[model samples]
Target chain A: MNDIVLNVSNIGKHFGGLQALENVNLQIEAGKTHAIIGPNGAGKSTLLNVCVGRIKPDTGSVKFLGDNLTGRKPHEINQLGVARVFQTPEIFPELTLLRNVMVPAFAKREGAFKLNAFRKVDNEAEVRDEAEHILEDVGLKEQMNGLAGSLSRGDKRRLELAMCLIQHPKLLLLDEPTAGMSRHDTNRTIDLLRLIKERGMTKVIIEHDMHVVFSLADHISVLAQGQIIVEGSPDMVRGNARVQEAYLGGAHV
Target chain B: MAQLWHRNDLLLMGVFTLAVLAMPLWLAPFGAGYPDLLQKLAIYGIFAIGFNILFGLTGYLSFGHAAFLGVGSYAAVWSFKLFTMNVLPAVLFGTLLAGVFAALIGFISLRRSGIYFSILTLAFAQMSYNLAYSVLTPITNGETGLQLTQSDPRIIDRLYVEATSGLPSTELFGLKMSGYPGFYFCAAILIIAFFFSVRIFNSPFGVKLLAIKSNQTRMGYTGYNTRPYLLVAFVISGMYAGLAGSLLAVTDPLAGAERMQWTASGEVVLMTILGGAGTLIGPLLGAGLIKYFENVFSAYNEAVLHQIFAMLPDWLQSAMVFVVNPFVGEGWHLTLGALFVLIVIFLPGGIMEGIRRLSSLVRRIIARSRRDGLQAA
Candidate 1:
């Protein structure tokens, strides 16, 4: 078996009376894509949030590369080689695409924070080149000088992905990499993921599209009402009776 | 060598140095070449530049920065009284004390952001002002202010020479810190402060601050602890205010409770906004313009206005005076307010943005004319 990059066990979260997540356990292996597929309220996002340290899970613990990630800050987790792509791209709208990617590079190079107030930002030519290379990899070299906010929804997603990939994260958590894209854009995103996967990077993708899930995921976990009903390979998850009754019955997937 | 000179920061520093050094010559035309107003310009320029490091870059509008200025003034005055009449010690002590005060206020105020942060600073400033006026009277000398006296022990100066004057004015070594010398000293400090600001604006630390301004949540997720950055900026700005305050004492040798007033804080905000907050040169321009209006424009009364309009017809002169009456003299603030409103409405980016727009428009016109000339040829 491949080494587990992330081990989230018995995680439970509550928002007042509502149970956002209940007894969730996920083991994301190294060099593989794990897709968490569910209905609208299946708590996929909540789990992703917990894993990234956005929300504190009430019970259980998250261990990434033998370090306890529970109750840590989002930035702390990010510094520990866990980069996240949000549901909607959260980029510096006023800054250029190159700068949008450079911020993460600076963070990765300078640790969480540093006081390099006297040195010129442009003097760090290596980081700038790395940012440019990543922007080129994501096919945003043409728009690298343009404002991140001016990009189309598809381009914004691509820019955000470039930001994460530049960090060279050991584990990437993507919350719907192609949520509001057309079929063409979605196919392009799938190809991007395939390219990333070829480099042996671990990814935990929370996606709604069954086509994306089946195409990208090496292993699939079917979550329904904040609990995973079945977890296995794509064929096993497709053949699971409980998953069919709970989620896939209504959808044509 | 050309590349070194061509760098943005070096070029800015060179321009600023030339302007400040030649202040006496250029400002003579504006009738503001006198030492007092020139020193005021430099001091307030430092204050606004410091304030911009936080407010302009991070978008943290501090409403209580005057507290630091007041603290700095008081500290400098005390330094004069106890230690020596040297301007250096006074300035140093004042800046350090203001930094400490800023750290204290910033630590508590930064917990809450946006308007809440602003209100917290305002409250703290008001508290400082009231305390300086009342309960802290023993230290602050109440409304009368802290002033140097003849009887005060001059431990450092006494080592060099006997008491020659009744009241020793502030000095740097043997050189008196009044008149042109004082203005030059303040100008030198202002240039240094401007250079530091330019460096901070171009540094990675500056980019982090801008990122924090753009999206704090994204910065946090990007693994940056933004609170420390904010606090550092706050303290640095406060130190700048303190330095300005120290210069005020160095030139005048008095620390007053009124220096800590909210209106004084508001003036710096006006300076930053009027000149263009984020740009390096904006705050200095704002400070000079406001000071010029306050000092020179307010001195223009009905006699001066009538004299200027003497060439015009009698009816036109009276009409002009009537129209301009509310904007000059005692009504100078009315003019400032109107200008502020107009800038906000038409040029939201402030004077720097106005300059940028005008320059771009000129460039466009020039480019079109060149194309037309080429076609004719």
Candidate 2:
């Protein structure tokens, strides 16, 4: 078996009286694309949040690469090589696309904080070159100097991906990376994911698109009512009656 | 090639710096009145520029930044009283103390951003002011304020130098460097501060600060601890404020609790917003504008107006007076208030943004004319 990178056991999270995620247990190995699929309130986002240390689970233990990730700050987890992409494509709007990619790269270089007051940013050709390379890899070399806000939604998502990729994260958690994209853009995103997978990145993706789930996920977990209803390979989960009834609405082949 | 250095911005700043540096020499013919006003303008400009970094870039509108300035002033004063009066140590102590104070306030206040953060900083500043006023009377000297007394022994006071009749000799190496020298010293420090701010503005840290301002939650999820970044920014800005405060005290060795008031804190924000929050030169312009109005306009009394009125016809003069009364006469604050409102409504980005728009418009017109000529050919 591959080394277990993440181990979540008996996780429960509640908002006042309403349970968001309950009795959730999952294990993900290195270099695996783990997909979490669920209905509206199936706790996919909540689970990702708990894993990244964005929100503390009421009752759970999250161990990431042998380190306790539960209740740690998001940046701390990120420092340990975990990065996230927001659903809405959160990016620095005023900065150029290249500058956006350079931020995390700079942070990683400077070690969380740096005071290079006298040194001009342009003088750091190494950092700039790395950012440009990542931008090229994300197919944004032409629009390197374009303001991030002016980019199309799909391009913005790509820019966000490039920003995270620059950090060289051990685990990349993506929240709806293809949300609101047309078929063309969606396919491009899937292609980008394939590229990422080819590079041997361990990824956990929360996706509503069954196409995205079936296409890339090594292991699929169907969540319903804050609990996992089924967990298996795509073929096994596709045949599960409970997953079809509760998640796929009996439409799965 | 796409140029990294913003050519137009650099040219404008260069021109502006030259103009400011030459003003004292120009005003030398007029018997030394202009340099004093110019120096005050530069000093406050430093204060406003620091305030702009926190409020403008980070979107953390601090209503209590004056407290850091006050802390700096007190630290500078104490340094002069106890240690060597070499000015360098005083400035360093002031900046360091301000950083320490900012770290404490930033840790607590940064936990809650927006209006709550503003209120928390304001509360801490108010507490500081009250403490300086009464609780720390021995150190702060209460209402009388900090001053160099005759009883105080000076280790490096340079008492051998001949002092001017009214002015105490703030000397360095047996040379009288108080009035003009003090102004020059402050100017040099302001230049350094400007350079530091510009570097930070262009760096990745600045980009991160803007990202935090835009969407902190997004930054958090993207592997940034927004709190630490914000706290660091706050401390840096506070240190800048402290440097400004230390400079003020160095120019005239006095520190008062009133310098730490909430109203004074608000003044720096006003200067930044009125000048141009995000722009480098905007804060300087805002400070210059406010200080100019305060010093020059306030000095224009009825006697100064009467001299001008004597040259015009009685009826015409009365009309002119009436027209200027709301803005320049007794209603000076009304003028300030109106100016503030107009800037907020019309020029929301401040004077620097206005200049940018005007220049861009001019460029477009020039480009169009050139294209038209080419098309005619």
Candidate 3:
């Protein structure tokens, strides 16, 4: 129980008549990369959304570090040290890269609400330095002043990762972090994830890319049709027959 | 970056202050040096600045801001009637009352966003307008509106001096709030409002508001409570509108229900958008331009047109008036409408975009000339 950073038990959700998720259970271990992979319309995203408090589940609850997060607000959950990187890189497109990173840092430092209307954001030297350092770590230091909206797809994803990293989250959730990246960028991201893994931060990555999953995940959960088909070490999941059948039945993810 | 940004902001503020203080001199050539027009420019400038905080930054459009203005006006007049002839208390009370009212309205309106929020604000303002016009006639003074009357208990003013010759006007200490002194007073408040807006634009709170505008979903997951930031912005802007309305009452003590009318609310929206929503100085420019058009341009008649086209032949002059008549005088809205359409289509950033384009064009020209000179050498 101490080793489990996030616990999802019997999370069931439906949209109208369509059963998106039913009797779902997941537990992410501390200091390990857990990958949730499934085919399209498998309710993979819905399950992720439920965990993040974006969608309220029909049944059961989500617990983070033994605290109930089932019906809590998204920001409330985030302030509890959970950060999400969206598939399409939901970022402040108009803000500069540095400002984008600093925003999340402020959120972490100031909590859910701070009446900091008089103090200059630039004057927050501690947060600014961390943001700059993180941008440098992500190899975006040269273009830190450029608007995030003008970034390439891969760069935007990288910026989003930097934004999350600045929060120093206990549980980092990445939704297809390399969704629109080129092969070269994907490989680069894999190396970056490997570096993050070395830091011992627990991460839950939702990915369709097997290369990414195999390269980064220590633990793998094979979700098919809103249910986990196989859950074990990466090697065991790779050899599981149910997982193979689940993938082969559809255009393989 | 902080030092450089601060210096740039300071320079802008300095220039703005100089421009505002010297308005009478600079505007004299254009026949807008008059006190009444100058006061309007300053008051409306403050209104636009506040409106931009909500609409431009957070992308929340409240179509009932003029209701706050009306609230401010009524509060200021009541202060004058009960407390003293001093403008200080009236201004403070007006702003405070407007802020409290905004807190109530924003709490409800902010529950919805986008067009729903705009509609909710509009409905609230209209309700306030009708109530003040009819239902709350005793307090609001109904169709006659709230005005200074000799028979009323002046309270503080009465204690100082017994008996009044006629109706007493508003004042600041001993300084009369009319003509040039009134313009200066409004200008000072406008400057203070502009400075606070500058601080807000630079603050973390401001960034969060922008984040809310850019991607609210991301802000939620980033752990920023968006509603409180939005409500604060709403109250601040509401206070700004209230201040503008109070200044109106200060210069000419009258608080009519028309101040809360939807058209007044719509006018502020036009000012903010017409200038540039997000930019610091843009809304002020928009307010000045709209106010100029409304006051100066609308004052033009066929007589003024004849004066302008006097160098031409009689027939040509008459023909010119016929062509130009619709765009000036009573048809100033036609001119304003055409200008607004052109601005929305061509320069969506309002006048600021045009300034930026011009400055960049000049910079390119200078850079090319310098490069050519270097090559020649």
Candidate 4:
């Protein structure tokens, strides 16, 4: 409990008459990869959204490093070191890849607001080099100068990861990061995630891919119908009758 | 690489300065080389360029920017009435007041985005226009507009001049601003504004704006409180409009409520989109084109057309005048509208896109010719 980086307690949300999330409690410890697995329309994304302050829970709260984030704006929560990667890669398509990486770096350094209008972008030598370096780590250095909109699906995800890495964020929330990757690209992403895991930055990955959940998650939570039905280590979750029911129904279990 | 970027920026600024300064000579053939028309070109050029910073970079689409321009001119005239007849105080006060107004309006309007934001700005600008025309007649001087008065207690002017019988125009140092001198004055400010815009386009703050336009969600999640950035851009652009408005008064010495009408605000929009929204020089080109149509083309009539066709036979001359009847003089708007439609259809990026395509085609032709020449050698 003391080492928990994120604590979502009694979170509940509803859209119109439909329940999107219901009483979901999740705890992510520092320096660990926590994976939440669920079938389609299982409220996994809603849970992540609540944690990142994108959704105001009808009931309950989220705390990040002992700071309340429930009522804060998304950007304010991000300034406190929580970065979210969207289910779809949300990137500045009009800007160059290096600029995309550099934008976040500026926000992280300058905070919520700074009228640094006079300083030339190219003259921010330190930030530029760091952006290039991160692109190198992600194997995107070769395309740093190209527009980000032109990147392949796999490369866009990598670029998103590089964007987060530059922020040096305390907690990274990833929504379906490998949702549409091929097997080769998926494995490459898994290796890349493993490389990041060594740096001890906490991550909460909402995924549908069982292989990815089994490979990297130190802890796993299985969500069903807007509730966390089962949770444990990968081995325990793999064997659990409830998780199998949640994933493939009663017949599969 | 940094040095190269700076050099390129410098080269652009240099070319822009030269082109603007040489307008008088080049525009002479088109019959727009006179001081009044040249000054209008420089003035509106500043207005469009400033509007581009907001609508172009951030994609905010402020429909009330003309309010800032109008506010600037009003403030400049007031400055001339109260403080000094000098151009410095008027320009500074005009720009500063417009910036202040922008911050206040942007704070409210930026709360929404897209069409909603545009509506909010439009509503605000219309309110200002109505208020200036009807409610705040005392300040705006209403239909007659804010004008310099013979009895105005201009502190600096009072200190310098002992005899004040005739109405005096705005001045810089001892150089009277009329005719060619006024055009030069406006041209100087336009150049400075262009340089400022070039710097902004290359700044980190500028990139943040583009990111906002591209993906506001990503920018917010990336830890930027986007409101501040938006507000800054709004104020800066507003300041630019104000400076332009002030230049208008500095040359001609009047600020009218007509300048704040919604149509005026819409004109700046047309200029930006017609020229090229995001490019550095596009707005200026758009402004020049629109202003030329409004001034020069609007002056032509049946007599002018007949004069142009005089060399032809009598029937042919009559035919030419009849054919050209609706596109000039009072029908200038038709000509501008047709041009706008054509530009939008053929060159979605406006005139800048056309220029780019033309240049690339030229380059390809040259490259092919050089290849053939090398093979022959």
The numbered model that scores best in DockQ is: 3
Can you write out model 1's per-residue Cα lDDT over B1-377, one digit (the tens) per residue? Answer: 32563486577788889999899999999899899999999999999999999999999999999999999999999999888898999999999999999999999999989999999999999999999999999999998998888877868777877887688888998799989999999999998999899889888899888889988998888888889999999999999999999989999989999999999999999999999988888988998899988998799899999999999999999999999887899999998998999998999888999999999999999999999999999
Expressed as tens digits, the lDDT of each residue in A27-130 for candidate 1 is: 99999999999888889999999988989999999999999999999889999999999998988887889889999899998888798898887787788899
Instruction: Superpose all Cα atoms of candidate 2 onto the true structure and report the RMSD in Å to 1 decimal.
Output: 3.0
- Deviation (Å) of A142 in candidate 2: 2.8
TM-score of each model's chain B: 0.97, 0.90, 0.98, 0.97
Docking class of 1: medium
lDDT of 4 by residue, B153-232 (tens): 88877787763688887788878889898899999999999889988888888888889999999888888889889999
Give the clashing residue pairs of candidate 1, or none.
none
Clashing pairs in 4: none
Give fnat for candidate 4: 0.87
Better of 1 and 3 by DockQ: 3
- Candidate 2, pairs of clashing residues: none
Q: In model 3, where do residues sit more than 4 Å from their true spots? A: A248-253
TM, chain A, every candidate:
0.97, 0.96, 0.96, 0.96
- Give the local distance difference test score of model 3: 0.92
The segments of candidate 4 whose C-alpha lies over 4 angstroms from its true place after superposition are A249-253, B374-377
Q: What is the lDDT of every predicted structure here? A: 0.91, 0.83, 0.92, 0.91
DockQ of 3: 0.86
Clashing pairs in 3: none
Q: Give the TM-score of each candidate.
A: 0.97, 0.92, 0.98, 0.97
Ranking the candidates on lDDT from highest down gives 3, 1, 4, 2
